[model samples]
Target: AREVGMPLKMARAVQVGGPAWHWANFAKVARNFEWEKKVGNSVVVREAVGVVGCITPWNFPLSQITLKIAPAMAAGCTVVLKPSEIAPVNAMILAEIIHDAGVPAGVFNLVNGTGPVVGEVLGTHPQVDMVSFTGSTGAGKRVSELASQSVKRVTLELGGKSASVILDDANFEAAVKGTVSACMLNSGQTCSAHTRMLVPASRYEEVRALAQAAVARFSIGPSLDEASKLGPLVSAAQRDRVLNFIRIGIAEGADVIAGGPDTPATGKGYFVQPTVLGIKASDTLAQEEIFGPVLVVIPYRDEEDAVTIANNTIYGLGGAVWSASDEHAVKVARRIRTGQIDINGGPFNGSAPFGGYKQSGNGRENGIYGFEEFLEFKAMQFKPSAG
Candidate 1:
């Protein structure tokens, strides 16, 4: 709560959004399912044994935690939550909220420790029926492997190296600003952030200028600052990781058109300015997910090249396509290999399914799609007796 400067009430609201939203939508789904149910000759469905192990990440700490916790509880499953050790304070607050919400004791449990110690234990625990993890692909793979030993179901939301394609016919100003803002959001810590921008060669210089201006305008300061648009990376290690990418970008001969490899001496905390890199499609900067306020601008010859460059990444999480005409933008978006594609300046709706293809990991989260992750389906058939 203190880290983001959110009030106790607002923090609670944010943490509880997942559960509240899930149940609200779940009720609608349940009602609809009931309407479809015929009262005769159907095998009765019975509730099974229920227990869930939820492992959440540091970014969007409370939100992710609640997403798993709330749905599990709503589905009649007891939960044991192991929040990221990097942001334990927020998790502690969440535990308090769960306790105050009058939830049962064994229904909700919060354990605080690093991934190796606590996370590993939870994943391998025989008592945990399922494991829900949100983190890097590497860690998620380990979680899946360990949980598989017990034949426990696993749901993972992992990393992304998303792309943003700005069509030749798109408004350069709007496209540039949108891409920059997307990368700057949450200091670019978001898994689905459009960090790689593909712009047409004709408007390359123009787009670069607009991106530089957008980066320059970003306010990087203490997390508590109301006016600060870009806060520090989650920790010192995260800050270093982002800085290393910046270093690699410079070393790989990409143009650092805007912010570069320097932390402000005035600030004692972990902070990095929003950086914009003008690079070729082949550059390393264009291929990696910095997960910071870092943007890679790659110029493409045409629509085909743009799509090629965008899909070159192993990650296919989320992306955006901008064009003068909605029809044109949708055409480009359809070709890109991503789970979610935004047209124009479309807002991110939590109601939609969020996940990825390829190495970005499997399965979806959010909306009815996410809820189905907990469900198991079976079809039964019977033949009428011949008398």
Candidate 2:
């Protein structure tokens, strides 16, 4: 819990509802699937991939584990899960729950250790049929490489440096405020957070001012504080990492519009100020994932320029577009190369396929698409019956 800074409400919702949602999705998909189907004179069948390795991240620990475990089990595949060592408490509770619920022995195994040890073993084990991972892009590449040796199917949910494009006609106040919240969510550690806010060059000053004001209003306190709008990062190392990025941004000629690399006076937890930087689209600050409560504002000349700036990153996990007209926002969203785009602050659909394109990693998760990751297909030839 100290690692991810998950608020009570967020943690409770995931603990209470995440499993139900996963199970319901699995049941619904299982019922709808054609278990045995005929194609001409042949039969096509779907079967469970034998063993699945579920490597979950510290952020949203319980839900990430459940999302991978539930679907794999529902598809009749046994699992070996490696929860992040930084926050393994909740996963332990989950394991107890599984035992209490009477899941078959050896069906679900839990291993506690560092990623380099336990995680690497799972990735390279010949007995493991598939591996599903969520973490940094560099680590995901390592996992993919290890799993490749075993010829195991691998699915990765990696890092992102997503952009939020505020069209020239968008509501400046709403877009700026919304983008700030999106960037600051989970203390800006969320992989899909829209850390780069792209605004029209004509309104860059206006948007930057509004964003600074909005960020100024955010309350920073302990994660458990009822009034805290922002919390400390996962660890001291993470705190230093983010601070280094902020320092790098300033060194690269970007202006710190709000917040800075200054450490909070608390001197206990790993806290960082909510920082915003005014930078060019090509600046290092605009292209990299800080993975903290640090946002970069970029100016675009036109709609085409906005799309170009948004798609310039190697990571394309998530993004958003805002405009008065839904059609216009979607037009701009479609031009951006990302796995998912939120138009005008659309509500998140839990059932939608979630993953990414480019270096953001491969394969899909959530809904029916995620469940199918633990399955394989077979076709059998048969003679046609004659009357």
Backbone clashes for every candidate come to 0, 0
For each candidate in turn, the TM-score is 0.91, 0.96
lDDT score of residue 184 within candidate 2: 90
lDDT at 291 for candidate 1?
80
**For model 2, what is the alpha-carbon lDDT of residue 323?**
96
- Candidate 1 accuracy as lDDT: 0.79
Candidate 1 residue runs with Cα over 4 Å from true position: 4-49, 380-387
Clashing pairs in 1: none
The local lDDT score (0 to 100) that residue 267 gets in candidate 2 is 52
Off by over 4 Å in 2: 1-3, 14-20
Q: How well is each residue in 47-118 modelled by candidate 2, as lDDT tens digits? A: 999899999988777778877998888888999999999989888988998999999999999999999999
> Candidate 2 has what TM-score?
0.96
